[model samples]
Target: MDLFEKAAILQYRHRRIGDPGRCVGWCSTDSQRLRFDVLCRVGDTSDSQTLATSVSTMCPSSSTKRAGAMVIFHAPDLCRPACCTPFFQMDYVLASGVLSYRCRNALYPYKAIRQMWEAATRGPGFNLLAANVFEASHVLCGQNQHAILAFSRTLDPAAELVTGSVTDDFTLLMRRRAA
Candidate 1:
C-alpha cells in the first residue's frame, strides 16, 4: 500500500466508529453483509453447503441457513463449531479478505494465499470456492488482472467471477476440477 493508504487505514483504525472521513475495512458489518449477499446469490443457498473461516458474520449458528444447506464455521478465539471440529471435509468454502489479504496484524504473500486456496479446492469432494481478496497490492503495483488470475489459480482456468468488480476488492466463485 502507498503512504496515503497506509495513513488512511491507520487513522481509520485508531478512531471510533462514525468518525468523520474514516472508511470501513473488509470486516465491517456493512461490508460483511455485502459479501454475504453475493455469496448467497452465487452459491445457490437453497441446497449447497458452506464452510467459512471466520466467526462473526458467517458462522453457522449466528447466521441463518438457507433451505437446509449446512453452514459451518470455525474460529478458535471467538466461536466453536457446532460439531466441535476444526475443519470439515466440506464441498464449499467461503473466505473473506481476512484469509487471503494482509489484514489486521497478519500478513501473507499473494502467492501463499493463492496456493493455499488452490490446494483447498483440490481437496477430495470439494466443489465451490468463493472468496474476495484485498486489491490494493494488485492495483497499486499495476499488475492488472495478473494478481487476480494468480489468486484464482488460473493454471487451467477453473475459477470465474460470480459477483463484484475486479477494479477493487471483488468476489470470485470457483469450481473444483473433476479428477
Candidate 2:
C-alpha cells in the first residue's frame, strides 16, 4: 500500500476498540458511546508492557492499562505553535470511557504529523483545546488514532470522520492497500 494508505490502516488497527476476545469494556463521550476489545498474542506481551510504561510516564497511573486487553475512551487536540495556524482537535468515545490524548512530539516527521492532525480536527466533533499537559497529550493521541480514520477517506468521502486509540505496534501498516 501507499504510505498514506498504510498509515491509515495502522491508525485504525492501533486505535480499534470493542471486545476483541482479549479486551472489552465501556467508553463514552458527551454525545457518543463505544465498546473496545484489544486483541493480542503471547509474543506481543513485551510490546504491551512498553505501551503501559510510556502511558504511565505521560499520564496518571490510573489512566494506564497494563493487561493484555482492556477498554477506554480518549479525547485529543492537535495544537500548533501559533494561534493563527490551523489546529486539529477531537474526542474519541472508546468502548470504555478512558480519557487519553497524544501530542505530536518532536519524534515524528513534521509534515506527515501536520497532515495527520489536519485530517482530524477538520472532520466532525467539537473543537476544544485541552487544559493540561496530560490532557493535551491525550487529545493529540486521539488524533494520532485517526491515522486509520483518515485512511477511510480513501474509500468513501461521505464516511464518518475517523479517529484512533493509542497503540504500540507499527506493523499494522503492512495490512493496508497501496494507493
| Alpha-carbon RMSD, each predicted model | 8.2, 16.1
Q: Quantify how close model 1 is to the true structure by its C-alpha RMSD in Å.
A: 8.2
Tens digits of per-residue lDDT for model 2 on 58-177?
A: 221222245422322222222221111245232111111112223234333233333432433222111111222123332233323344335434533443422233222211110112
lDDT of each: 0.41, 0.26
Clashes within 3 Å, all models in order: 0, 30
lDDT of 1: 0.41
The prediction achieving the highest TM-score against the true structure is 1
Tens digit per residue, CA lDDT, model 1, 1-179 = 34554555445444534542332333455555665555544344445556564423442322345467666555422211222233444555555433332233222334333443444443211111123333344212222234555556554365555434222345555555667
Q: Choose the strongest candidate by lDDT.
A: 1
Off by over 4 Å in 1: 1-30, 41-49, 59-64, 76-88, 100-145, 162-168
